[model samples]
Target: MSKTVRIPRRSRAGILAAIILGICLLLLLTVGVLTVGAADAHPPRLVDNAGLLSQAEADSLRATLDQYSEELNFDIVVVTTNTLDGKTPRDYADDYFDYNGYGYGANRDGALFLRYINGSSKEVWLSTSGEGIKAIRDADIESIFDDMEDDIRANRYGAAFQIFAQDVRDEVLDYRSYDTIWIFVGLAVGLGVGLIATNAMRSSLKSVRQQRYAGSYIKGNSVNITEARDIFLYRTVSRVAKPKESSGGGSSTHTSSSGRSHGGGGRSM
Candidate 1:
């Protein structure tokens, strides 16, 4: 004959608690690993190689960039370099954005503001990627440069860059709004066409006639109604003006040295 041994209630509770704790720890570890992997995917946003900004200024600008980038889901980067390593300003700016993992999504949606300093002369380039190509038009790029020109010429690099970041954010937002409006217009047009087609089809059925009462289509006692009334909730009114014609075009794109397409423009300062 054999005797069965039983575990104490306290011991059993302790074992169950330990197992739960282990599972929680494992989940936390997995989450931590994923977070680190995601962070590692994107490179630094501000690279002051020429050391144009003081530490305090760099920190403040970085915070601004990070805030806008997160809100817009687009990367906005700034780089200051003493040399382009023998490459043209355009090529250098494009390569740096592409190779350094500066973009946000798979198509790498982002924009880079490069300020290249060579002795007494300075050159600035704006490189855009992915949706950025659509958002930052040629006119918008010129406007950005125009806004920054005075500060840049006065050796206020920090102020100029701040303007660059803010202008890029505004342009992206405006483009998105414009695109959304077109989408809604398309949807409205489609709905109207569908309604017209459906009405035409219904009109072809001569046997069907308009019902004078709602109960005509319902089975007796199937639905009960004590009282009913139609209520007007709201109304919408829209007015649009004729769009003015302009000579300027949208963003112009070119293939970068890395075989990736980029939209950008550069100016000597």
Candidate 2:
């Protein structure tokens, strides 16, 4: 008799290949999504307009300039500074910057640089990136001028400061909220890809195990019947019961013993 052989399952390399393949598929899908991906970030960058400062803000500065110029022949240049220089402006329509002086659609910290086009010999320059006028006030444009005047009169720059701390503070706040959202989205994508790889590897490993014992193993829902023996059932021929008859003139009789018996081939007496 021919013996039945067990089927061999797949190997580790095979399973590893499957998992790697699944990961590659996921990465390909990610690439496709990127081609058409929408915003999935914090503070919900889902809108077309993000991080855009208000027109009123620029106008307010303009108003301040106009107020400052109330009967003078000077020009007020209100350029929205590019503080973070983030990839996109915070808003749909805002100031921009080019090779020349700052233009519309540019995003930057709140700042106001002031100088006399043709007036003060004692020039006052003010620039800030504050959230509001309160923050602007903290930069103390008025005080800086006052101090500069005093220092010049005394022939000493004891009040000299080339940079302002308030601009950094303002820019940090604006970019902080947006940058965090971008980071969160990136992390989520990476995590999802990892989970897909893990599950695919587990599935491929199970497939390999099943291939190892395909012919002999009776795979139940969750468990495999590995140790079951193959049984060949045979049957000993059953004997037929014989009929009994009285001691008469024309009758035959027989008795059954163990597994042997007589049949109806005998003739009557």
lDDT of 2: 0.36
Cα lDDT tens digits for candidate 2, 25-103: 9999998787666422111101112212245433444444443322221212233222324422211012121112221
Record all residue pairs in model 1 with backbone atoms less than 3 Å apart, i.e. clashing: none
Candidate 1 lDDT over 1-269, as tens digits, reads: 99999999999999999999999999999999999999766677899999989888899899889989989999999999999999999999999999887887788999999999979768999999999999998888999999999998898888888999999999989989999999999999999999999999998987989899987988888887899999999999999999864436877788998899999998998
Question: Cα deviation of 187 in candidate 2 (Å)?
Answer: 43
Best by TM-score: 1
Candidate 2 weakest ten by summed lDDT: 260-269
For every candidate, C-alpha RMSD to the true structure in Å:
14.4, 44.4
lDDT accuracy of residue 49 in candidate 2: 20
lDDT score at residue 233, model 1, on the 0-100 scale? 100
TM-score per candidate, chains pooled: 0.70, 0.20
Q: Residue 73 lDDT in model 2?
A: 18
